[model samples]
Target: MSPNGSPDVQAITRLVEEVKKCVEALALPDRRAALSSLRSAISVLEDPEEAAFAQIFQSPIYNFAIRMGVELGIFRKLLERNGTPVSAADLAAECAAEELLLVRIMRVLTAIGYAGESGEREYVASQLSKAMVVPYLEAFAVHSSEHSARAAIRAPEYFKLHGYKTPVDSRNCPLQFALETDLHFFDWIHRHPEKAKRFNVCMTGNKLRRREWFEWYPVAECLLKPFERRNRNDSAFLVDMGGGKGRHLEALMKSFPSTESHLVLQDLPGTISSLENLSSGIRPMSHDIFSPQPVVGALAYYTHFVLHDFTDERCRVFLRAVASAMTPGYSRLLLNEAVIPERGCPPVFATGDITMMLVLAGIQRSKRHWVELVESAGLRVVDVWVSPDDGDMEGVIEAEVAS
Candidate 1:
């Protein structure tokens, strides 16, 4: 072993130097590769016991602390200070939490670099902590802790009980097993108004992280060009199927403001009724996803980050419903989703696959899987458009009715 107890410190040091050079040259791809290598190197170099504690035990402690901090409005209070550190006593008094408990939570946050430790018994919010004040981010934390985390804990038990088979039953999956409910995940959320609203807000957070689909896809040629020549009776230009709060539709309107063709946003009745200030060009329609498509022969039917919430069997049924409505030669089915790589898949996606299995009985599909899944629904993959940006995790899969 080397002086630092790492078997390969020399290689790791070279990697660090390479990463620095890439950073100086502004070589994003090289930098990303170096960073990934560095992470792997560090994992190997780290003390196994420490790594185990950090991975299995330390994360939950920090998560619980952050959740409690959000509940007590500590992050917001820290943000209001504008980088000025506040004493534990002052923060506790303001947030109405016990001083000792608040300090313990702050210690965990500070240890994780989420909050800055300035002087003894004083703290300041980091950028991450400031970001936590956003409603969507806050909601994401709450939703994950309350729902996904619980399901994840039960996933092992669920697998053992179910003979380690992939979960495809929407109503009897890990989320239901953990929460002890029979309702489908969406139905369960809808039944709780506040939780439903938070879930919608959490979804909006995803949009902020990545480029909108229209940005990279051939929207003008594929959608607008066809809209001008389409059958007049087919007034619906685009349908945002299962679109929560119509954010994507609103985005499409902004992206192609000149188009006067119909834009419809479909969702559950509760979701549709709660929508406010939707662009007048976008029509909000209440429609069950599993039901037949009500707006027929639309230029395109778009589902954004929605499909992974279901199983292959359920998706086949849902896609068939959309396919039945397509005007074979003209209508395109746009699926904006992640396409997991067949080999060397990133940990984020691998984790997402498990999370989907646990909570939604769904999956993150590979390119092969996407083709198979789409074709299984009587649709043919036309193109998969992904951004040239290296970190873009999602893409648009353009499909149409098979000949």
Candidate 2:
């Protein structure tokens, strides 16, 4: 290790050179890939025991600490200091916590490289910590730490008790086991209004800084041009099923301001009632995905990350409902989800698969799995548009009623 504590300075320098080369001539995805490679190279230099300890203890502890920091507005307070290192006592005062307790949190944060240690008991916010000050990011940190992470810890015992069978029932999954409740995950969240709000915020947070679906999808070629040809005459152009708070519909409306078409956002009545500032052409409807889709033969019925929450049988029921409403060749079903590859899938998505298994009995679907699911519901995939950025791992599977 170097004096600055980074491993193998010469190796890192070589990796940095590679990253610089990629950044100058490559797209963002290639640049990100190079950066990932650099990180992997650096990680390989870690002592075996250190790595083991980090995986076994440091990660969980840091996750909890980050949530604690978020609850106390520690990241925001640090950002307010504006490059000045604040003493633990000052931070404690700001957060209304004991100085010693604040110091303990700070120690872990600094050690984890989220905060900079300028002097004894003094901390400066790092870029990551400053970024956490964003509302959605903060919500994700807190929600995941408090809910997902805790439930994940119970997953092993959940599996052991169930004789290691794969979880296919959402109502009786690991989340139910962890919370010791028979309520489905969504039902449980609904019962806790505050947590439900945080969860919705976290879901929105997942979309932040990522490319919008329209950015990668050929929207005009697939939906608009055809709609104009038919002159659908005030018909719904897009129906975002299970759309929470109309975020994606808002984006769609904004993206195509000149197009005078109906954009519908559907969710449960409770979620629809709370929506505010919807774009002029957008409509909010109280509709459940499992129920018969009330809007028939829309140009496109879009569902984002919705299908991954249930078993194949449940998904089949929902898909069949949408299929019955589709207008043959005119109507389309667009599913935005992580299309997991059959082999060598990214760790982030693999981790997400396990988390979904633990919490919602959902499995991230590969292209093959998606095709099977679509066909089983009397729908056929038209085309799949994957985002060029691998980090996003999101794709839109366009499907329509089977012949």
Candidate 3:
């Protein structure tokens, strides 16, 4: 084998000829029919659209039911009595609500497989429903409901008053609209300290649910491993630029304990101050990355679910600030954002992109668009790793300072 103790040239030539024959056969009429049959058989294995639509549309109903159940302490009540199937009338009596209203909501949940109906009026908690009984998951439902309410309340006013043409009018971003109308989400919640606490609890709940996905993060593991092995003395920092309340950092730390990293939870002053007593090992730093990132000397800077919140210009500014913080050779940047597929990929991210656009004048980027953004910020893309399960919903792009 060309002096490498492998297959020789003649053997390689013969193998290539055999492969060419196979390729030629794939083009033949009978082989084409076989290929078509194989594809049809594969499609029967899973109906993707049926699963996706159910997930996207029915999720809100399930979330709402969970929130209502938590509010009424239904799960806790059931668990106290060892998860016995209780009557709707009894549940309503306990919560001092109308039985009909409670049953209607329960019916929606039962249809979606969250709860189980026992005979005519009785209900039993399913495993999924039991999972929602946890304090964190309950709080998450509340938080999601709060955001939904905020969006609903503002949508009509935003459309009529501001001459807002669509949900994603560039003039009125979600952050700007929330700030203008609600005077910032947390700011309003700050007045009610209990609500603020619930908000944090809800944020933490989302982290708990999705942190497992990080283990499957291909590029994050690949890029961070080198630093963990090489740099023994200095703690390599992962500056989570715009990391909301250090939830992502907490998740990352849980997943990668050896990767010595500190979270720089950057946000608005009001948002930062509210999260003063978050927890140990999380240094909540207040700095607007859109202005100019103050803290430097980070090993690998990270931005997750942040870039899609801003317009392209603002995204450029954000990236430039990250670039400015980096020392040429050492620091690397990691972007955990969706890389919108060109054509053949699923429509989940595309639909998400539309939601972002409608809600906050945000747009998801394609790979080429991301490349442009990276290059524009004086950084060059090293590699991109897409999750096999998630397609491009949570892609990791490793970038370094451009030479």
CA lDDT, every model vs. true structure = 0.86, 0.86, 0.69
Candidate 3 lDDT tens digits, 1-403: 7688864768757865775577664634455455555556556755889867876787767777878888887777666656678899997888777999888988887787677887798888787778877778788678656654456545666567757564433545453454465344445567788878887676555334233436666635565665655564545467777776766777777666654335456777767887745656566778787878777767778887778866777787788888887877778888888887878545556766765664556778888888888888778998776655433356777788898
lDDT per residue (tens digit) for residues 10-99 in model 2: 876886787667577977777678778766866886888998887997788888888888989899898898999899889999999999
Q: Return model 1's CA RMSD, one decimal.
A: 3.5
In angstroms, the error of model 3 at 31 is 31
Ranking of all predicted structures according to TM-score, beginning with the best and ending with the worst:
2, 1, 3
Model 3 off-target regions past 4 Å? Answer: 1-67, 149-195, 209-237, 243-286, 340-355, 388-392
Looking at candidate 1, what is the lDDT of residue 193?
Answer: 90
The residue-by-residue lDDT of candidate 1 on 1-403, one tens digit each, is: 5777866767767867876666777656666676687788788778999998899988888789888878999889998999898999999999998999999989888887778988999999997897888888898778999888999888789889999998878888988999999998888998999998899788777767577888888888888888887647448888999898887888888878854448899999978998888888888899998899988888889998889888888888889999999998999999989888889888878988888988888999888888899998899999988766565568888999999
Better of 2 and 3 by lDDT: 2
Error of 1 at 307 (Å): 1.0
User: Could you tell me the TM-score of candidate 2?
Assistant: 0.89
Q: What's the lDDT for residue 66 in model 1?
A: 82
- TM-scores of the models, in the order given: 0.87, 0.89, 0.65
Q: Tell me the lDDT of model 1 at 39.
A: 83
